[model samples]
Target chain A: MIAAVLLSLWIGSSTSSIAELRHALFSPDERVSDIAIREIRWPRTVTALAAGAALGMAGTLIQGHTRNPIAEPGLLGINQGAALAIVSVAVFSGPLQPWPQALLALGGALAASLIVFGIGRVDGRGASPITLVLVGAAVTALCAGVVSAIVLLSEAALETLRFWQVGSVVQGYDSFLALWPLLLAGTGLAMANARGLNALTLGEDSARALGITAPRARGIGLAAIVMLSGLAVTLAGPIAFLGLLVPHVARRIFGADYRWVIPGSAVCGALLLVVADVLGRMLARPGELPVGVVVAMLGAPFFIYVARRRKPVTV
Target chain B: MSARRTAPTALLLFLATLAVLCLHLSIGGTPIPLPDVVGSLLGISPDPRTELAIMEFRLPRSLAALCAGVGFGVAGALTQTVARNPLASPDILGVTNGAALGAVALLALTSQVQGLPMFLHAYGLPIAATLGGLLVSALVFSLVWHSSLESNRLVLVGLGMSGLCAALTSWMLTLGDVYNAQQALTWMAGTVNGVSWADLAIAPLVIAIGVALAAALRNQREVLALDSDTSRALGMDLGRDRIIMLGLATALAVAATVIAGPLAFVALASGHASRLIARSTVPPVAHSALVGAIFVLLADLAAARLFSVVLPAGVATAVIGAPYLIYLVIRQTRVRSA
Candidate 1:
């Protein structure tokens, strides 16, 4: 992941040699290459790293707690909820900085999760994973519908929204920086709860026998997920499937243990997103595809493949 | 699933449609008095202004909404019956996104270094959209058609595909210049704004044929909800009928998108609404169509008048429809559990 991030930082529209990259890193001077590396490439790479890692962790926590392999922030409507909140600020409130916007986003994500979970659990047996997904899809569509309405009604909102609506790691150095502390706190919380989560995965009855209070552990897991997902979404709009794909990849590499899966997910997601971003930069020369779009283009096929090859998804 | 259509329910729906259609025709960016609207319709209005508004603007727009609504409503009903799932509307099933993506892809390809070739540009969107929708239906049908179709997997996979297509559309927009992006985005937002006589031309013909095709296959289409052996015993070829039903549904939805830019919820809401109004588990095709038309017309009316700015009609429908979808989901879950 570190190598991938470093590689992304060096290569973009204007390629800088390793020597130039080293010079930019160590003996930074007022050179065009140095400035590009310092200002443009570095921040973009870091933003992707932070957002990707957070999303990957959030997916891990969400899937772990939900006991649903397909669960992710986007599929759970968490990201849309956060984005809707930020967009609402852009539309209704005067204007907010990145810090305040992200705070608003966290609140929004929490609200959406409650609604989604509430709707899902209405089934009486608790909402099945499939049910949660279906309800989440509906909620995401609804939020997106409302967001579009807000954008259409206000010019000021549109200017900010059109770009954000499509998730990207375009230009948000401050926002990304704002997320760093929360990301650390959330990651720490997730890692701390990992051992309990692994036990909880044995089902609530077994988890209770193992002396893990299932509900309390699940609550911690949800909070961590909300923090990671909300902040990531606020930093970059909503990068679809990052959370869903990464945990699976992580588990493939490191096994189902939450301790290994969490960090592994962070590594895999950051690497994947950074590479996707770089590839996106290369794909459209003067212009660029959003990293989110590239991820979807790649992830959608993978999603189908997984859905097809696996056991029929159930509760 | 079929039940007797109650007279009072039919009368209620009929009156609602008539009243809304009248309201739709009589009002616009500027409201014309009811007398002037009727006078213009009868060619007896003294004012040329009233005639122009009625003929050139208001009439075409309202007609487009009604026809498109009916098309979407019928399509929604067909799809729901075929899938045996009320949630399987064109929009939810990714047909709308597929059509929109196909149309936008065509637009982008043609408009790329130079604008679209005039012939393709002028006549291309509906064709592209319909073909796109058909393609998606084929893919969706094949994916879920494991000896027998599984509606659950179909909806799940369809939702995934819809999101994927939307992402692809967004990518295409990003690659295109700003003006094209704006145009495509507005279309995807789904609106009947600026619909004209030209826009309404192909829809009526296509819808008429599609509805006739659906009616002809109505018995076989309903047999879809039956198990394959029973349907076979009943002289229905499950595969052939399913394809024909899906094809017709896709065409109707494509027709709706052709006029309304993939308007949301009408397909889903109208089907469910019509089913309730007709008091049948089988959504009555005619009732669904009528209810759909009334729904869109009313939604458009709210969008145009209820807002300080004219909002897209799709947004209004979604605002009303999505919650209803959630409610339906909750209710369905409850029923199943019970």
Candidate 2:
């Protein structure tokens, strides 16, 4: 991850040498490459790492709780929810500062998840995984519909959304300052839920037999997911498939233990995003593709592969 | 469920569609009287402004809605029938996003590449959209196919593909300038706003032929709804018929998407709406088409007239249809568990 961050700093629309990186770090000169490294690329690298780690951890927690291989924050309408809130604020009022925008996004994500969970919950228990996913899709469509309606109606809103909706990390460190504590809290919650998540993975009833309060464990798991994913979306604009992709990779490497999976996912997610950001810088040249778009390009095929491989359920 | 019983329901729906059409044509930001709209339709000039409003703007937009709605309706019915899943539709199955991706990519490219041939701009959009929808549908079908398509698996796989296509579409949006991105975004929301007669040239004809073809294949649609073994036992070639029907559905959906951006839920709701209204065991294609037309016309009317700002018809459909979908899913789960 550190190496990937260095690589991201080194490559940009204007290439910089390794000597320049050393100079930026040790000497702290005002050379163009040094300034570019400090001013533009460094903050972007931080944003990518923090946001990517948040998303990865979120994915691990949610998949662990749900035990559904294909589930992710985006799939469950959390990302769209954040997007809708941010876009609504932008449309109604002018663009918000990074702090307020992140807050609103977190609020929106919470509301949307609650709605999905509320409607999808059957009495005391959750709906079947497929039902919940379908409900989430419906909610996503609804939110997306409203967001686009607002965007299409106002040119200003369209301009704001066009950049933000695609998930860019170009905005720099203001978001990171506001976001890190929340990200830390979410990570802490995720880590704390690890043993509970492992128990839940053995099935809710079994988890109960193991003295884990199934609903409380699920709630904490969900809370962690919402916080982590919401901050990531606010920070990086709703990068799809990251949450879905990372946990699987984490599980492959770290086995089913949530203790390992949680940390593994965070590290892997940071690594993936840092690498993707570097690639995005390289691919578009000068303008640069958004890290979200780059990740989508990388992660969507994996999503399809997982979908294809999962055993088809009998109707 | 009988054809005889469905006749009056169909007629009622057709009349409702015409009423909605007239309502759509008569009212806008500048409201023209019904008499003026009627007079303009009859080739009588109700003054040049009214004439332009009716003949140039409203007519094409209304007709586009009508045609696209019909296409979505039929396509939705066909998809549902083929998959044996009421929840399966073009939008949900990634077909609409696929079409949107194609159209948006072309729109972005035309703006980015500079000095593209005029013919590509004029004719390329529908072709690109159709090809994209077909390609995604093929991918979804192939991914899910292992001896047979389980309805649940098809939807899940389709959802996965939809996410991928949506990401690509967003990427395409970023490739273009702000103006182009705005245009693509509006279109992606399934608006018929600013649709000129020229923009709608191919959609009407294609929809007409597709609907006619669907009506002709009514018997096959019915047979294909049965279990594969039963369908084969009845001397039907299940594989060939399924492909032809699915292909036809894709074509219809693509044609509709070309006219208006993938109008969400018109297809999904149309099938179920028509089925309920007609009290049919299966969604009747003709009735579904009429219902779909009504759905779009009403949605457009609500979008354009009801809002302080004109929103896309797709927004209205989604806002309305998504809840209905939730209801259906809830009902289905209840029934299943019971």
Candidate 3:
């Protein structure tokens, strides 16, 4: 992870000398490279780390709670919900301050997930993986339809949406600073929920026998996922496939233990995003490709590979 | 249910598609009388101005919607039959995304490059989109074909490929002029608003061939719906039949996409809608095609007339389709749980 962060900080459209970077790092110099490094590169690198880690942890929680290997925060309609809310608010009442934007996003994400869960559930039992995913797809389509309608209706909304539609780490540090607490809270919640997730994985009845209280555990886990994903979307827009693939990578590396998987996903997710961001910067040259684009391209083949290897009916 | 039971449903759907097509033709900017519209469609000129409006403007748009709908329906029926999964469609299987990426890349490229030839500018997109859809379908089929194509694996592989294609298309959006981006957005939303006779030159012929191919595969489709082992036990060549069906479906999807820019849910919903109405085991190809045509025509009508600002037909279809999808899922859940 450190190596990945260093690589992101060092590489760009233009590279700075090592001595200059070192001098800038220590003395807060006023050179162009220093300013770029401090203002643009540093925040972007940190934002990437924070958002990636949050999404990775969120993905782990979602997959664990849903017991669906294919589940991701994005697949749960959280990203679309947050996007719809942000776009609607922006169109109706101008751009908001970062705090309100984040709050609205969190509200949107929570509402969307709740809707998916509510509609997906049959009887009192939680939805099957296929049902959850299908419902998620429907909700996502619905949100996207409305969003496109609003975007088409207003030029101001269209301009705002064009940038927000693609996930990028090219956000101001202020936004990151404003939302970092929620990330920390979400991470802490995820860590706390890990053991319960492990217990619940055995089965709800077995988890109940173990005194794990499946509903409470799922509730906490769901909250963490929504918080992490919502805030991550706020900081970096919606990064596709990052949340979906991170937990699988973590499980492959750290085994099925939730305690290990949670932290492993965070580190791996951070490393992957930073590397993808660096690659995006390098590949596109003068204008960088969005990190979301790069990650989706990179993650898709892995997704296909996973799908091929897994059994058809179950994880 | 057999053909006898479904024939009436098919006939009704056919009449409905024609009625919707007429309504689509007559209700645009200037409302032409039904007699005049019918006359224009039958090669009789009501007058020069009305004839121009009907023959030149509305006819092409209506034909684009009809042909595109037929293509999507045939493709959807073939795919769903082969996959044996109710949810499978060319849209879900990455063909739409691939085609959209291809078309958008061409438009963005042409917009950036100065003094491109008019021929390439005008005709490049459909060919590019068709090639793109075919290439991605080939990639998807190749990836999933380990001896025989498995149903869930095919859908999952397609989903992954579509994700990649969608990402590339979005990145392409940032390439050139913002005006070009808006144009790409409108097209990607699946509008038939600006389709002209020239834009649709290849659509009718390709769609006809697609329908023929689908008809040829009707027997195989029924057998393919059974378990692969069962079908193979009954002397059906699972691998060969799946390849043919998927290939035919991909071609039809490409044809439709080139005309209407991936109309969102026609392919996904048409098969199910037809089966629901016809009470058939498999979505009958002819009935599904008629249902698909009516779906797009009605969607286009709503898109053109119901909105304060004209939106793409794809938007209306999605709005209609998503809820229907949710309802389907819920019903499936109920049946399974019950």
Candidate 4:
């Protein structure tokens, strides 16, 4: 997957320098090749990898914590919250700034998480997965409604946000650069808690008996989800299916152990996203398809198959 | 089950709906005094502009709300009954998204076809939207029909279809230039803006079809409320009945979507609400319709007049409905726990 994505990146970048490709690859000067590799291909490749990994990790965390198979960020209202916040910024503000949009998206995501958490926590023992999903669906629908209203009311913002809303990876390198700190922090936390997450799968009572504070573990898991999801949204809009798809694929390959599942999902997610980004770049020639759209087109069928095959899991 | 308790609750609901209608008519940007509005309704007022404004703008808007609401309500109730799941609705079934995609696509493709007669456009949009919705419903039905129609599987398929439709819609928006994209985006979000006399005409006809079909399916749906095997054991043609009920529900959903553009959660939430009020395991269709109409009418009124900057009624419903849904889930959890 990595090689494929790299090859696609090379092809995309070389479009502007088609005449010099053979010389650039084996030249003594090496300046042209260096510039092409560093300036054009590297940022796009890295961002795609990072964004995909973040979403994959986030999806795994949500599925693990909630114990629900279908709980992607998009399905759970996190994406909608982040998208709404970002759109609000793009529409209301003249130019797009990464930090503020990131902060606002983080805020919206956290707010939505809290609401879902609260709803799930109703039994004094957290929400059932089904209830949580329903609540998320409700919140997602509501947020979509509000976002639509805002877009309607503000034409300029709507124009700017349309592409972003479609989930692109081409917001330039700055947005990717801006997301690095959050990505590092989130990934680091999630990796650190892999054992705890695995313990969580044994059921709350059993995990508690095994010396994990179920609530604290859940809280940590929630934090990890927020960070990863926030960073992913900041980098590449709300690409759906990555988080849901990557982790499920990882689980199918690596079994249900969080120790393996978490890292496996991360790698799988990065690869999936990079390949998707590469495909998006190549599919329409010069005018790129957004990675989000590519993933959806690819992911939707897989998701349906997963849904049909699996028995419903509790959150 | 006391008569005294049932009578008062029904009475209260009726009065509340009436009060909401009055509020809808009386309140707007140019607020006519409540008495003048009431007097105009009674044909006693001589103030022609206020009357015209109230009769023309407010009345149709309120009526549209009522019709859409009831349509949504019946659709929701039918979905819940058929699926035996509280979360099931036309929106979840991909009907609304499908309809909206159809309508928006038509509008986007026909940029040159603007300024046509209002009647032509009105008929055109709903027809296109209904076709889109029915198409999706057909796809979903076909995909899930091989298996026993489990509610969970049906919802899962619906969710998948909705995601696909949403992606397609987003892609369409992205492909369009800024102006057309903006228009499509807003329309997808849903608005009662630009509603006209012709639009009103489509509502009544579709709604009539929905209601008549719903009435016809009343007994069959009740049987369907029982488990599939039980319904079948009772000599009902489970497969055929499921198809008919689903078809009718889809029609209601398509109609509501055409009129209101997937007004968020009205169908699902209102059906749930009616079930709660009816205190029955199965949602009564008539009660659901009444509840849906009340919910939509009130929501529309609130959207139009509540805030200084008028939001679309869809936005208002979602804002209010989403949190309430959370509360309901929490409440259900608590009940289950106890």
The top-ranked prediction according to DockQ is 1
**Per-residue accuracy of model 4 over B3-78 as CA lDDT, tens digit each:** 4544555566767777777777787777788898788888887688988987887787777777788888888888
For model 4, what is the alpha-carbon lDDT of residue A245? 91
DockQ of candidate 2 relative to the true structure: 0.55
Best by TM-score: 1
Which residue window of length 10 is worst by lDDT in model 3 chain A? Answer: A164-173
Candidate-wise lDDT, in order: 0.80, 0.82, 0.82, 0.75
Residue-level lDDT of model 3, residues A253-305, one tens digit each, is 99988999999999988888889889988877677788888989888887777
Model 2: TM-score for chain B: 0.95
- TM-score winner between candidates 3 and 4: 3
The first chain of model 3 has a TM-score of 0.93
- TM-score of chain B in each prediction: 0.93, 0.95, 0.92, 0.87
Per residue, candidate 1 scores C-alpha lDDT tens digits across A15-123 of: 8999999999999999999999988888888888888888999888887877777777878888778767877888867456667777888888888988999899996
Q: How well is each residue in B1-338 modelled by candidate 3, as lDDT tens digits?
A: 67788888888888888888989899988799998999888888679899999988899989998998898988888888887766778987789889988887887788789998898787888888888899999888787677336455676677788778888887777675533533675556788887888887887898898898787777888898888889889998888888888888998998898888877778889988887888877888998899889888888888778867878888888888888888877887787788
Candidate 2: clashing pairs of residues: none
lDDT of 4 at B44: 82
lDDT, candidate 2, equals: 0.82
Q: Against the hidden reference, what TM-scores do the models get? A: 0.95, 0.94, 0.92, 0.83
| RMSD for each of the candidates | 2.3, 2.7, 2.8, 4.7
Per residue, candidate 1 scores C-alpha lDDT tens digits across B1-338 of 43354556767888888778879988777888887887888889868978998899888888888988989999999989888888888888889889988888877777675854688878887888888888887887787777335446677777777778888877767665534433665457677777778888787889989878776776776678776678889876777777888888999998888888777789999999888878776787778888999999998898777767878787778777878888888887888888
Clashing residue pairs in all predictions, respectively, total 0, 0, 0, 4
| Clashes in predicted model 4 | 4
